[model samples]
Target chain A: MKFLDFFRSKRPSSASIAKERLQIIVSHERRRPSTPDFLPSLQKDILEVVRKYIQINENQIKLSVDRNGDCEVLELNISLSDPGKK
Target chain B: MKFLDFFRSKRPSSASIAKERLQIIVSHERRRPSTPDFLPSLQKDILEVVRKYIQINENQIKLSVDRNGDCEVLELNISLSDPGKK
Candidate 1:
């Protein structure tokens, strides 16, 4: 009990919690695909196209989905680095 | 129209297409975070731990989520390199 006593945690709002979980899981899946060997090429292609709009942080792009009955919602977390004093 | 005629496409059912979209979106979201500067340390920590269980493909780790009413489901694509013919 003493080990736990030092930390006080508050439950997060359902939306925030869901968003957080979504970000983490999407990161994991993107890095590990069904076919592992082909990922490097895929990454290169993605990065090349992605660089046009934004300088990707290379570590924060996560993609995922939610199935609502028959409709599927795609969730993308587009985190951008500091615009660098622009 | 001729350019379009060269391509033949079949409409994917809501399920298969959803999965494909989910994978791509998750990949994007994981790479972009609310806070970009903190991602390197996160990746390093995750990789160091993940190396022991499996040689993570590194390029495919997409972390994401699905919010079901009040519950958040974490979806992780755990892809591994060939088990090395063990």
Candidate 2:
């Protein structure tokens, strides 16, 4: 039992932990997996939904998230399309 | 030696591999660990550097990244302060 417990209870080294944490941060900072292809799909959906009611300046839309410790804020910025165009 | 090699060579379970991948992607997707407090420091630096030449419309500035498969792009948007205000 003592031998089994010793094997089971050995802690991970600090360097490995730090490396793991760094990897997590880099992956998050880089925004993994989600493709840039998503933007056109989103733009199409948004325009389809909003075009009849109001013109949209598709160029100004922004979606982002900022993290501070455990707190996170998601930002959305959208500007109205030029009225003269309509 | 053959038995030792077999024990050493067993590939990690697929579920474990997937979970590790997901953890990496989530940590990356969430933009791990960078504090929002850093923004105030950045704003202060910008204001100090640019105050003599031009007022900055800090509200309009954006820094973001978009990724598509292996490709990644970083975006920076800055709008100058209203000239009339200065």
**Residue A76 CA displacement from its true place in model 1, Å:** 11
TM-score of each: 0.23, 0.19
Kindly give the stretch of ten consecutive residues in candidate 2 chain B with the minimal lDDT sum: B20-29
Q: What is candidate 2's lDDT per residue for A25-71, written digit by digit as tens?
A: 10111122331212223324433433343344656454454443222
Tens-digit lDDT track of model 1 for A1-86: 11111111222355543332222321212222342333333434434444443455646565544433322333344444342212
The iRMS of the candidates, in order, is 15.9, 20.9
DockQ, cand. 1: 0.06
lDDT, candidate 1, residue B85?
A: 18
TM-score of chain A of 2: 0.29
How many pairs of residues in model 1 come into backbone collision?
45
Docking class of 1: incorrect
lDDT of 1 by residue, B15-86 (tens): 543332222222212222332333333444434444443445646465544433332333344433342112
